[model samples]
Structure formats: C-alpha cells, structure tokens
Target chain A: MPELPDPTHETYYSAAVNEALDEELARDPAVVLLGEDIGVYGGAFGVTRGLFQKYGPERLWETPISENSVVGMAVGAATLGLRPVVEIMFMDFIALTLDQILNSAGKLHYMYNGQVTVPMVLRTPGGAKGGYGPSHSQMLTNLLVGIPGIKVVAPATPAAAKALLKSAIRDPNPVVFIENKRLYPRRGPVSGPDFVQPLECAEIAAPGSDLTLIAYSAMVPLALEVKKGFAAEGGADIEVVDLVSLQPLDTDTVFESVRRTGRVLIVEEACRTGGVGAEVAARIAAECLDVLEAPVLRVAAADTPIPSSMDLEKIVLPGIPDIVRGVHELMAW
Target chain B: MEPKPIDLLLDCFRKMLLIRRFEETLSDLFERGALGGTSHFCIGQEACAVGVISAAADTDYIVSNHRGHGHLLARGLDPVRVFGELMGRTIGYCGGRGGSQHMCAMDHSFLGTNGITGGGIPVATGAAFALKYRKESRLVLAFFGDGAANQGTFHESLNIASLWKLPVLYVCENNRYGMSVPVSASTSCLPIAKRAAAYSMRGVTADGMDLLAVRRVAAECIAHVRSGAGPVLLELETYRFCGHSKNDPRVYRSREEEARWAERDCIVLLGKRLREEFGISPDRLESIRTEVDAEVEQAVAEAQAAPSGDDRCALGGVYA
Candidate 1:
C-alpha cells in the first residue's frame, strides 16, 4: 500500500469549498463565479459566503433563475478564456441544465477538434439530508459520469474536497464537482492554502489487508464508521478506500486493494441500479476475477425515490450498519 | 464606424453568393447519395448572416445555430474546410468530428453552432461578459432562429444580458417555421422582438431579405452593444427557399407562398440593388457569379478528394 500523505489544518466541509474558491479567486484573475442566490444569499448551502463582498459582482455573479443558461454561460465563458465555477442550488435542479452541461460544455472541446477547452467547474450539493424530499435530495453523480469529455469528482473529506476542487478549477476540461450535502458540517483536517489534490487518484483513508471497503462522497465517512466497528470486533483488517475521482476510476488503488484483500464491498449513496458502485464492482470483477476470494458486493441506496421522512430515508439510504453487514457477508463468503 | 464602402458590399455579396452555391452543391451531392445525413440550409436567409457578420469586427465573436453555413461562410471560414467537414474528411475544420452543427473556428471568433435550439444564446452572453470583464474592445453576436425564441433559455439569456449590460447582440432569424410548425403557430408573439420589452431592452425588426435593411439595422445594433450600452434583440423577418431538410416535400406550405418568398430572395434582392443603387454593371455581377461558382466547384472537388476521417482517431479528442 502507498504511504498516506500528511495534512495541515482542520475545517468544515463547506468552509473547504469556500476557502478553496477564495484562494483560487485571489490567485487568478480569470476565475469567476455564477449561480442563483450565491451572492447575497452566500449560496444555498452557505458555501460561498463573503465572496460577493470580497470580489464584488463582476467576478461573483448572482444570476437569475435559469439553470440551463447559468451552465451555458459558464461554458461560453470557459471557451472565451475565463474559468467559471457554476453552482446549482440543488443536485435535482441539475437536470434542467444537463443539455448545457452534456451537449455544450462536455462536447465543445472534443467536437471542435480541440480548437477550445471548457475549463469550467460545475459545483453542486447532492445526497439526502434535512428531509428535502425527492426533488432536492438526489445523488445524481452517475449522470455526469457516463458522459465523455467531462471529469466527475466526488471528494470524501474536507481536505480532499478542498484540494480536489482547486485541481478541478485548474483542470483543462469541464469538471462536475459534486459535494455531498450531508457532509457539509463534518469537520476534518485539510491541507493549507497551497494544497491541491491530483484529479485522477484515489486515497486510502485506512490501511488494511483482510478486506476492502470502497466508497466516495458521503458514503466514505459511512464506510469509515463501518471500518471502526469491524476493528473494535477484532475482525479482519478492513481497508477503507476513498474514491475521490468518480469518472476516471482510480483502478490502480482499487485493483491493488482488491488483490490484497481478495474480498470487496462497494457502497454508494446513489441508487443501486447503474450507480458508481456497480461500475466499480464490474471493473473489479473483470480485472481481478482470479484474485477475488468472493464475488464483488455493493451496498447502495435502494432503487426508490429518496423519501421525505427520516425513518423511510434511513431505510432507503445505505447506513453504516448496511456497510458492516455487507463487509461481514463478503468476509464470510 | 464609417459607412461601409462598395467594396465591403461586394465582399458581402461574394460571401452570400458563396454560401448559396455551397448549399446548392450540398443538395446536389446529397441527392446523388454522396453525403450521408440531412443538412439545414439557409437558402433565402443569406442577407441576415452576411449583413450581421460583415458589420462585426474581426475580433468580435459570433455563435451560430443548426442552419449556420451562411453564417460560417460570411464569418470567413475557408470554404474548402467547410466542405471537408460536411463531407466528413480529415481536412475539415473539426477533423470531421463536427459535421456542420458543431464545427467551430475559434481563430475566427466563430463559436460552434448548436443542434439544440437556443443552446448557444447563453454562451454568447457569457462570452460578452468575458469581453466586458476583460475590458476587451470586442462584443459577441449570438444568432438563433425564430423557432428558438420559444425556449426558456432565449428569455433567460436576454434578461441576464440586459441586467448586467453584457455586450451581446441577440439576432433572431425568423424564417417563419420550426420544422413543420409555422411562426404564427409556435410563437406567442408575432415578432420575437416584442418580447424583448419584458427585459427592458431595445428590440427592432427588419426585412431580413433586404441586404441594405439588415446591414443598416445590424450596424446600429452592433455599435450600440459594442459601446457597452447593453444587449439588443434584432428579429430579422426572412424565409427559407429550400425544404427544412432533404426529407421535406413542401407539403407544409402552398406553391404561391414559396414563389412569393423566392421573388423576395435575398441574393436576387442584393444583385438588383447592386446594379440599381451601387451603379454596378450586369457584366460585373455576372463575372462575380462565375468566379464564385468556380471557387465553390474547386472547394467541392478538393473536399471530395480529401482522405476520409480515420475511425481509429474517432475516440480521440474527447478530452484535451
């Protein structure tokens, strides 16, 4: 296993996004932002607080209620040499702007024979919390993942979120930077102002060899909780892998972990059908068929709309117990 | 900023004629099964593309739509490369990846055209924002069809452009139909220009078939927007002489309506105006036609002879 890198400071998940954006804005003149209520309202999740006052309206744009155009505007700005970060208020609303994101921003760089690059970041908060109901609380990362010419990043911790988002802003392609809504208040150590994560690598949050736990975004912390429980029980050494880059799968880390453990349990907050977990499981099955001691398993949200009630939500969403059960089942196999 | 000279008008005429001939040649090729897919042609709407683009500075930006060959040609994209792209050749502008609707000439400030209706409007507005933010002495012109005016993006884009005073000229080429739906049927308002008042911006309508009218109006609008007065909406009333695509059999409209629009053809209108107003001789116009025909023929020949785009590299360039 690769040695873990050291971090520098501690901050909340939302603060990580805010600090990264502030630092990027200070470092480059071309970086700008646009979204609904992001200026005075400081974003729907309060992730862009104080940026409006610091940079003013020129760089920080408070747009009208037009999701498609907001993303479209970002694509246009990116093509014309401006790096724009667009925030959709909710992940569900991203459906309105998929045409711009998929058809225009994602394809412009390639369709035009590399004549231009869409160096833009579409930042949105997904995952279920606060009883927001189906429309607002959807983990739709796979929608962006399936599209070519776009990078999809779903960081698991404050440090990972901050570093990966900065890298996403600096990347030469369009990036869908999805933040998990449930992780906004989760406090963790983040690297200092200069830290930037690689856009194509995954992080091994916990080192183990007996079994592997794979997850990303909000599910990573849940997987960690499962790892802690397994450790307390004096069971197998459960290694938890944080899949930070979702689209360009970090197969090196995944394959190595699966080969070492010979047992795998993938977890995701999104629906089970056609989720990232399914893809990761398929990759492991195809690449490490002989190495696997058991069939690859996935613990994802049930194939149903996210319920409004917390009781029903718990049943629908994958909880820490669900990950533990899956890990135990895989080990027994 | 001065009144454009006769040479500029002649240049516009040449480009408009080139686009007309280019589309005609494509029709002939498609008829013979040389080309694979259906293409949207701007047959009678040449003046809108020529007049609007001619008024724009070389540094200014222009976004086009599906029916965009005239716009691309008028923006000075090489006819040979344009033909190569339509023919899916390696020598094309986009290496044959973008057939017609998605090709872009970034060097010429011509943003790619969109197959999705009203998709490029906000992008143009964003480019306008960049231009103004960077303090560059340039603006963007986003061209969409009247059919696109119904899209929420069109209204939303205009609202933002006006609010922020972005340097964008939103030109709507109202050729009267969105596939089979006529303008009167699809549009809530007769002229798309009237809706601009809701955004608190100036809107104007002009005869899109008349080169002089389109040029005069577009020049004023371009200057106004370029000077940072904010965005302006210009709805050009025009018509398409050809069917929407290769599949149409002209069952949607009467022969009398088609004949009426053909009589007011922009290319014929400009040719007559050149002889009557500009004191150009019939022989000179005839010579210009002959020269443009030869140039287009040569471009078609070169494009047809060019190597087909490699399928091996088809998966490449999905990311930079």
Candidate 2:
C-alpha cells in the first residue's frame, strides 16, 4: 500500500496567492508584485501582508485604483523584460481595465509580429459573496476565457494556486490567473511549495470511465467530493477532470475521458449561461458529438447574481448535491 | 519664457503646422468621406505634443491619447503611417488593426495612445519603474488631458511614480475642456498642478502654446526624475483648436475665447519667431516648409496605397 499525502493547513485563497508571490519573489529577481493596497495594507484580502517589508517598495508596488492603468503598467513592465503579477482586487474591477488586458496585454505579441512578449500575470479574486454582492463579486472567467493571447487559470487548492501561478509567471504569454476569493487558504500537498504545474493540462484526480465531470477553481473541489460520494453510495461511476487553465482548455484530456465514459458532466461556480460549462459542452459537441451516449449535463450556479445567504448561496452555486444529481441523471441515460 | 534658436524649435514649429494642416486635412476628408472612423484633432494644442517630444531622446518612452497625431508627427512618426492608421490600412503603425486612437510605434518609443482615457498613465509609470529597476536612464513621459487628471489611474500612477522615485515625467495638457465639460466644472481645483503637493512632487506651470516653455519645463522634470528625485508634473495650459473630435462643433466654448487662444497659436507664434527673431531667412523657412510638405504628401500617398489588414482579427496579442 502506498502512503497518501496530507492536505496542508488552509488559509483562504488570498493567503495562498500571497505565499506564492513571496516564494516567487525570493526565488526570482525578475518577478515583481503590483496591485492596489498590496503595500502597507497587505492587500484587500491580507494575502500580501509584509511583502512591502520583504521586497521593499521598488519590487512590491502599490498602484492607484486604476484597473486599466495597473493592467497597462503590468503590460509595459512585462514588455520591458520584467515579470509582473498584477492583482485587480476584485473580478468586477476588470471592467475598468479591459482595454489594457484585452487590447494591450492580450495583443502585444501579435501586434509586434512575435518580436515582443508581455509576460504578465493578472491576479484577481472572483466569485459571489464575502460581503460583496454584485459590484465587488463576479465570476469574470466567462469573459476572460473567450479571449485569445492570454491564459486563464483558476486554482481550487493552495497547491494548485502555487503551482499554476509559478507556471503562469514563467510562460512567455500573458496569463490571467484568477483566485476564487472563496477558495483561498484551502491547502493540499505539492511536489514543491514552489512547484509549477503545466498550465495546458486538466488534472484528473480520480480514475473512472463511466462519465467525466469537468470542473475548475472552487467547483473542482465540489465535483471531486461528489465523485467520491457517488462512487460510494450511489455506485455511480464518474471521472473528475480539473481544468486548471480555462483559456487554453485541455480539451484533449476532457474529450478523451468523454470518449471513454460516453457521458460528461460539467461543474462551474459561474452562472450557467455563457459560463465555462457552455464552452466545454460546445467544444465536445462540435468535435466529438458521436462519442457521447447522453447529453452533456452541467452543474452550475443559476443564471442569477450570487446570493449572500449561506443557504441561498448553496442553492445558487454548484454544490455536491447538484453535481451528484447531474452524475445520477447522466448514469440513468 | 523666451523662445530659443535651438534647431529643435524651428523643426517642431513646422511639425506643428503639418499636424494642424494634417488634422484640418483629415477634418476636411472626414467631412467629404475621405477618411473613416472618429477624429480628435490636436489643432490648437500642438505645442505641448511638439515641445515634450523635443525633450525626449531616442530611447525614452511616451504613452499618448486618442488625439495623438501631433505627438506622432512630433516624435518623427511618418505621416503615412499616421494617416494610414486613421484609414485602417495595413501600412499603419498597428497594421490598421488599431485605428484613430490606438497607434503603436516601437521604433520611436511611442508605446501607444489608448482610446480609453487615463489608460496609458499607469503604463507610463510602470515603464518608468522598470527603468529604475533595470538601472536604465530612459525617462518616460505620460501625456493625459485635464479630465484624466481626475481618474483613479491618474492618482495611482502619480502616487506610485513619486513613491518609488521612478524616472517619469507627467505632462498634463489642460486644454480647458475634457470632451465638452470644462475643467472648472469637472475638477474642483483652479490649477490642477496644485494637486502635485499631495504626492510631495515638484509641480510647474507652462504655457502649453509656448514650445520653448514646454520644452524647458519638461527638461527640468526629466532631469529631476533622472536624478532619482522621482516624478514631476508639468501642466501645459493649452486649448484645442478644433472640437473634442472632428464631429464636435465645440458649442461649449465662446467664439471670443477660441479666437483668443488662436492668437496664441503655437505654430503661428513659432513661425513668426523663426523668421523674425532667429533670422532664419524666409527662403530657408520656405525651403523647410517645402521639404516637410513634400515628405508629408509622399507619406500620405504611400500610406493610402498600403494594403489593409483584415479587421476580423480574432486573436489578441502578448499571449500564446
């Protein structure tokens, strides 16, 4: 029998991001951190606590509340041969800087005929709740996933957060690494606390061939929990695939599982309509429709703003029950 | 501030004239359907753009605005590419992909002039920070309007630029109106440069219409920034010769005020000085004009003839 790795102490998603930033800064001179209040305040979420003390104001910069400007600054900094991990505080704030991210950060490589690459990683906390209703909370992955020239990543665990961010910072292209504000502090084992996972692969945590459960970010943890419960009680077979990177979605792994299982269930914390679930379903249908034995089932939050109440939040968000029911429904077909 | 006999002075004056005429040309063309998309002319406030670039070396960077033809020309960007960009042709700076406002020319260190207001301010600040980190002497100039002065990014960039002691020059072109809204109505301050005190930065006021004053102020700020004293702000009190854009009738301003600024026309003022004070012979001035006019026309012809890119570009840049 082999030994199982223990999950590390959970701190919350912001803490994981801050640890990764600290590790990366100590590890590489080129890696710099920029965001609003990441200085004396240690970030809005306390992820960047004491970074200003360690790295000084030169490496750890705190910019004004200008998403566009901060993003643009990140781009220019990256273009000039520095690696900048820019934090946008909240996902909704991206609306203010879409031009810099969408136009400048996302277009610099192609615009310069591949001569210039802006190696920047934009980190923002997303999801509903946490005292923020509509204005502060939003799942921006839906909008960011559709854009080209940028890699979008959402890590559900501390290990995944640290691993994926390291990879994103090293990659040649710009990356939009989203930290689900709700998933911070949750921890798991990593090959190295400073390890970097491949950004283009979906991690398959459990092995099964009956049906594939595609998920990312916070939804992946929920889907995995449901998969374990489904295997034990429902005796329903399900394969859990964590799409670590959403933009360059590792569709090959997903489709391969779909081909074997002959069914698919996608779980997303984002609203169902235009969510990453829709993207997975459309791609599977368009590319491998014949391989599917049943319709692609999706366990996603309702197409409404995330409610603040814990009870309502559970109902609105994709949870274990919703995912289990989705697996059960697919099994029946 | 007195005008200097520096060659840059005469050269910038002609460039401003060319920009005025070029924008006026675009306005005429836009009216007759010769050019497409929105047009924001730097008609009256050409000196700020012309003068600031005069302080720039080949390596320094600039982040401009939508109304950037004057800066583009002043920075020695070929008119062909500028006009080509407005017309959405491949020969443009960004291959016609970015038209009217978003023009990128790395050769001259003009990173971009974003369509969104206050978008480039942070970027310029970041570039300056990078220079300090890399130990490069290159100074970056971020040019924004009076309206952008109120933006969160404006505050963020200024704050960081001063806090980090980065080599950056913040040039604010206070042309009275941000779009149709007057500065007095949009901002709570009479002189926006007074706000520099908030960040512990040195602030100076320059007659935006006077190229030499703009150049002198910009040079001082650039030196201050390069010496590791951090960023400084220079407010060029200028006025827009045309409306907010080509379509704007500028019903916001009185004809009296418009004519008053017109009398202070930078190009007109510079040309008179070039001929009268510098004793640059009328023939030499005429020769310079003839030479620049021919070059601008050739550039226009070549840019117009340049092929166009498919505006249907589906992918973004800077990523794989």
Candidate 3:
C-alpha cells in the first residue's frame, strides 16, 4: 500500500468527492455518470464541477428531470458492465426513485439469481443543517438503512467522504451514498487516491471511558465538538463513534464501546421515530443490556417537518447543546 | 413482400408453435391447480414474440415484461428449464428464485422479465446506452403491454433514449387491454406508437397477427436501431385469446370479439403460409405438431422429477 499524504494538507468535503470521482473515472473506463444537470451545470451542489469538462459528454452525460427513469437507466447500465454513478439532486427527491432503487436495482441480483450484478452508486445530498426546508433538508438515512440488497453509507469528514465514495463506486452491488450538505464545505485532511474506507465498519472519532456517544454524517462533527467541550472542562470522558456505514452497521464497535463506557447515547439529525438511532438503541438493548449502566438514550431531530427559519430549524434539529444535555442526562441516570 | 427462406420460415413456425403449445400447457396446468402462482399467457400473441425476436441478432439484448414466456421461448431458452422454474425446481433459469414473470438468461442476453408494467423500458434504454458507449453494434429490444405506454417511465425513457440516440427498439405488444381496462380507456393517444413521435423518434404500427408482416416490420425497426438512428417504437396490434391470468373472468369482452381475433390466430396463419407458400404438407405439419407435443410432455415430466429448490439457499443471492 502506498503511504498517505501528510495530515496537515486539508481539502473541502465537496472537493474530496470530486477528487474521488475524477480518480475513479480515470481508473476505469466503465465508470460513467448520469443525472439531471450534472454535466455542464457542475451538479446542483458543485461536487462534479470540473468532471464534465474533463471527461466530456460521453462520460458525464446530462439527463432530464426524470428521477425514476434516470435511476432505472443506471441499474440497467450497471447490469451490462458499466459502473454508473447517478446523482439524485437531493436526498428528498429519492422518493421519486424508490421503485427503481429498492425494487429493480436492489432486487435484480436476487431475482436473476446472480446471473447479473448492478454495480452502481446513487450519490445524493441529505441532512437538515442546510435549512433547505421540509422537502430538501431531510436526513433520510433512516429510510435506506434496513434495505437488504442496497448498501447505505454516510461520511462525516472530507477523508471519510473521499474514501467511502471510492469504496462505494467499486462495490459490485447498488450503494446509496448519502452526503450531508452541511459537511460539503467543511475542510479536513484526506488520504491519497488509493485509500478506500471499508464499507462495513465504524470509526472511533474520539476515545473516552465515561460514556459512548454514537453518531454519523453531519452529527459526527457535532458529537466531536461536544466531546471537545467536555475535555476542555475536564468533565466526563465521552467516546465518539462514527457509524459511517448505515446498512450492515458495525455493531461490534458500538457494543464494545457501550461495554467499556457503561453508558451510551445515540445522536442523529433525522427524526427520532424510525431513525438510525432507534435501531442502534434497540440493538444495544438486545445485545449489551447486561453491560449498560443506564438506559440507552438518543438525541435526534423533532418528529415534525423541518422548518425553514433558522430559529425553528435549530430547535427542530439536534445540535451540540442537545448532545451535551443528553450526555448529562445519561451521566445523571 | 419478398418471402424469407423456406428453412427460416419453417424454424419460425416451429418456434411460434412451441410458444403456443407451451402457454396452452401452462394454462391447463394452472387451471388444474398443478401450478401455483399467477402466470400471464401470450396465447394469441406468439407471432409478435417470435417475429421480433427472430428479426434480431443472437447477440442483441432483450428486456421483457410479465407476459414473457413466448419471448424467452423465441430467444431459444430451454423449455424444460423454464418449466422447471414454474415448477419451483433448482434446475430452472433463476434456480427457482424468480417465477414465471421474472426469469433471466444472461448467457443468451435475454434480461429478466419484470413484474412492473413499464419497469423494463428504462433498463433496456440503459443497456442500449452501455452498448453504444462501448461502441458495440448490438441493440436492445424491450417489450411491454399497451397499458405500460401510459406509464411515466415509458415517456421518460423514450426522451432520454431519443436525446442520446441510444440503440434500442421499444416493441409494444398492444393487446388492446391492460388487464380488463381497454387501451382506449387508459391511454390518451390513439395508438401507443404515436406517443413515440412526441420524443422525436420513429413510430410504426404492424399487423401483429400475421407472422410475416410482424417479421417484416421488426426487421426494418431492428435495422434502423442497429444503424444508430436512435430508438424506434414498434407497436404490434394484437389481441389475447384467453383471460389475462388464471383467475381472470375476462367479463370485459364478448365471445364475438374473441372469435374474431381467433380467426386471425398467428399459428393458423403461419400454418396456412407453410402449406400454400412453402409447399409444406399437412402430414408434415401434423408430424411437427407431434414432435412439439412430445417435447413439451418430456419437459413437463423432467420438470416434475427435478429436485425442489433448497430452502437453505434462500438468502444466498441477495448480494453480489
């Protein structure tokens, strides 16, 4: 393996995503892109800015505003040996594509009995921190978590964003890559182009002994911030675990952390009901009930439509204060 | 029109006859409770399947929908294995995982038939995109019912295929009904082929009952697609003789209409052509019938004796 670059050099999350796409397109001729306004428009979020000019129209094909057919097209192309990475502008718009993504792309391999594989990636921006309102600002990772055939991955940092996307593009099955709009502009150190993060593992963002704080995507950085505040005040040492891969979640790391800390708290930007935190809490209750010091707690967004106003959005979405308060409640319990 | 070679006509006739017999046997089995689950039969639409498939190259790809047994049979897949799939045996095309509506033979380049109405349209368009991107000469043919033309995917996929000029042929088996609701009731357009013109693509309607006519139209459309003139929507005006499925009462249509369609039965028309045009004797036709009946009987017997799919492997192929 080649050595990674120095950690001092940093790049934005969106740039890291662009770098991964550039490298994969150059690496494999079969990796083509299909989406609405992804070509000359440089993508809705600018993640695919220079790719259109670099790869030309044949590689970076623009599509109409048809989400269902675009995804269906990707699944069809993938079966025929092209690794198409489709961009569904916002994660909210994925509702228009559930049939193709869940039924066709997800079930084709099993339905065909392995005669064909749909090697494709659906990259969409999700999460609530953008204040994009009810339709666009949904952290819909919960919707894709329990699906069997499709894999869902959310990256917290620039490095994880780059590495996880590379890994998702290379996976032989359909992978729904959820990118948090809030994390797009955040800068962090990314490894070399050869680095590919494992799709079925969690990373301990920070280590501690007092409590375990589990989060993912945009919530990971917030959890880390809460951990840092506690460290500065010499409060309870909280361990932050980033659940990068939502589907096929790395429960071993979570259970181990819960056992060590004896207290656990799950945080997410998605609604509390039917969120990834609910599944994690249930798993901890089922498997690590004996080791827990208190009930597993969760800090998630309010169970209502995310508002557009900053004040209302702040109250509805989980923030640093909510994580701190949850930790305090867990410690008190 | 000029006649195709006698030998080729004979082969097409045999394939069409086999599909007819296969669907008839399936309908019988379904009625007897010997076969479980629903099956959509292409009893009267055999020529559309055989004619279009025969007009294409062996390497060309095919995407089919629910009423797809005839399509698979015409593409030269084993009847015994297809029967085994319906019988839930491990020797089937999908190892008994996919039922009648969802069987794939990738080695033959026949993608699996979809249960969704217009599900295979965009997939076929995408496959054509892949072939074109790789600079291959092969084209993809997608089959769907007239009801599917009203689906959003049909319109969306046609636009993309036309814009990119993908090498694909969208073959609509306009059997005039979408499971009891007639095309006139569901679709806004007069003929589904006219909807193709909205996408700036070639649209043609063929006489689906006549095997030679369908073959001629399919040949032209296939040649047009293979030559990279973008996708063509070829509507085969056909009808179904039986109920949509085993449980369908088919109260929507009358016996008079059914009899009228039966008069133009594709099998009978091809038999007449073979007797008059090709000089094939009735005794020879009877022998061919006997041969096909025996083949179907052997297939049914072998499929019945085949081992049931193992329950332990139920979750094996969910991922790559």
Most DockQ-accurate candidate: 1
* True-structure RMSD, every candidate: 1.5, 3.7, 2.1
DockQ of 2: 0.41
- List pairs with backbone clashes in candidate 1: none
TM-score of each: 0.98, 0.89, 0.97
Model 3 - which docking category?
A: high
User: Model 3 Cα displacement at B184 (Å)?
Assistant: 0.4
Off by over 4 Å in 2: A1-23, A36-57, A62-69, A88-99, A108-116, A128-138, A157-159, A181-185, A193-195, B1-5, B310-320
Q: Give Cα distance to truth, residue A332, candidate 3, Å.
A: 1.2
Q: Write the residue-wise lDDT of candidate 1 on B221-301 in tens digits.
A: 998998888999999999999988876887889999999889999889899999999899999988999999999999999
Writing each residue's lDDT as its tens digit, candidate 1 over A1-333 gives 233256777789999999999999999999999998999789989999999989998789998899999899999989989999999998999999999988998899888999989999999999999588889899997687788889999988888889889999999899999998899999988877787889989889899998989998998888888788878989878999988898788999999998898999989999999878889999998899999999899898899988899888899999988887888798888
lDDT of 3 by residue, A1-333 (tens): 123355435799999999999999999999999988888789999999999999999899899999999999999999999999999998999999988988799989998899999999999999876567899898887778767799989988888889999999999999999998999999988877788888988888889999999999999988989999999999999999999989888999999999999999999988899978999999999999898999999999999888988789998998888889899999998
Better of 1 and 3 by TM-score: 1
C-alpha lDDT of candidate 1 relative to the true structure: 0.90
lDDT of 2: 0.80
lDDT of 2 by residue, B1-320 (tens): 54455576777877887887788777887898877778788888888998888887767988888777888888888788788878778777776666777787888888777776887787788788788889988989888899889988788778777777878888899999999999989999768898898988988888999887888888887788878888898899999978998778778889999988889988777778877887777787778777877776777678878877763442444345
Report lDDT (CA) for all predictions: 0.90, 0.80, 0.91
Tens digits of per-residue lDDT for model 2, A1-333: 012244445455566667778888888898989888999899888888989998998788777666777787888888778999988888888988787788778876765445457889998888865556767767878888777788888877777777678888888889998888767756555434545678887778677878888888877777778877877885867788888879888889888888888899988878888868899999999988988999988888787776666676766777787777888788889
Minimum summed lDDT over a 10-residue window in model 3 chain A is located at A1-10
Given candidate 1, what's the lDDT at residue B210? 92
Ten consecutive residues with minimal summed lDDT in candidate 2 chain B?
B311-320
